[model samples]
Target: MKKTAYITGGSKGIGLGIAEALLKDGVNVAITARTQNDLNEAEKHLKTIGDAEVLVIKSDVRNLADEENAIQQVVDKWGQLDYCIANAGVGKFSSIDEMSEEDWNAVIDINVTGVFNTVKSAIPALKKSKGYIFTIASLAGTNYFEKGAAYNASKFAIVGFSQAIMLDLRSYDIKVTTIMPGSVATYFNGHTPTAADAWKIQPEDIGQMVVDLVHMNPRTLPSKVEVRPAVPPSARK
Candidate 1:
């Protein structure tokens, strides 16, 4: 049977790219997002790619119940899950003094809590299959910059959480990895991915890395991967 993967925020961006790559490799994929329209559109695009089974679920990952339901939906359809990608995250840029509590909460709730819920809900099935768990974090998880107080905090928390889980799940032969990407050309931050952004990494590049990692020897685990653009645009003096 083909391996099954559950990817949160798979309706677009890096999540969608990974799903597409896995589909081409004959892996079944279940994708979740908050919007039904987005899921529907993603399903259509996934179909064009390959023969892999594609399941779409509408879910808001911040809600524990929703995350559980999404995982259950995948298990019901696919029977087992071999991979879990907690890629759903949100970001807001603001100085610490100007950041509102609501903004901070929103970032934390979606980035930190959402990842927690995704992993918690999928752990049972993952333990059963001895599967792999990959978290889509940011370079901010380790590096900080201005106007990134809330976003940085959330990502930093994710790195620590992911590393701890890696240790916790190692006994089960379940691998855990945190992928921290610096800059990617995607429809993130209200900007659409474009050729002009070729200098930055592409979503598919990350997808390919996931595929490679999955195919590695079981005894080897690359716990952390930090990726960045080879060259970044600089302001003219």
Candidate 2:
């Protein structure tokens, strides 16, 4: 039987990319996102990948019940889940003074709490399969920047949360990894990816990285990985 994976926020960008990669490798994938339209579109694209079965679920990761339902949906369809990616996240970049309460809460609720839900809900199945977990974080988790108070706080929380869980979950022979990417060329932060963003890390790069981790030796665990473009704008000058 082909391995099955569950990915949150898998309708687009890095999440979708990872699902596509895993699908191509003969891994059945179940993707969850808030919007049905995005999920439908993603499912269509994912079908072009390979023979792996694709399941698209409409779910919001911020809700624990929703997360649990999403995971249960995957398990119901596939019988077992071999991977869980807590990749649902949002960003609201603003200085402390300018950021609104709603923006702050939205970021924290989705980026931090959402991940907690995703991982927590998937733990039972993951333990059963001794699967892998990937938390898609950002460089802001470690490197703070101006006008990034909300986004920074959320990412930082996720990084710490993911690492702590890595230690907690490792005893079950389940691997956990947090991937912090610098300036990936995606729809993240409402930016339209174009040729101009080519220099930045591509979503597929991160996707392939996850695939590689899945294939790595069980004894070797790269718990935290920070990836950036080889030639950033600063370096190009």
- The window of 10 residues in a row where model 2 has the poorest summed lDDT is 90-99
* Residue-by-residue lDDT tens digits, candidate 2, 80-186: 98999989888888888888999999999999989999999999999999999999999999999999998889889989998999999899999999999999988
| Candidate 1 per-residue lDDT over residues 1-237, each given as its tens digit | 899999999999999989998998899999999999999999999988888899999999999999999899989998999999999988899999999999999999999999999999999999999999999999999999999999999999999999999999999989999999988888887998778888888889999999999999998999999999876887323
Clashing pairs in 1: none
State every prediction's TM-score relative to the real structure: 0.97, 0.98
Per-residue lDDT, model 2, residue 46, is 95
Which pairs of residues have clashing backbones in candidate 2?
none
Q: What are the lDDT figures for the candidates, one per model?
A: 0.94, 0.92
Q: Assess candidate 1 and give its TM-score to the true structure.
A: 0.97
User: Alpha-carbon error at 205 in model 1, in Å?
Assistant: 0.4
**After superposition on all CA atoms, what RMSD does each candidate show versus the true structure?**
1.5, 0.7
Against the hidden true structure, what lDDT does model 2 obtain? 0.92
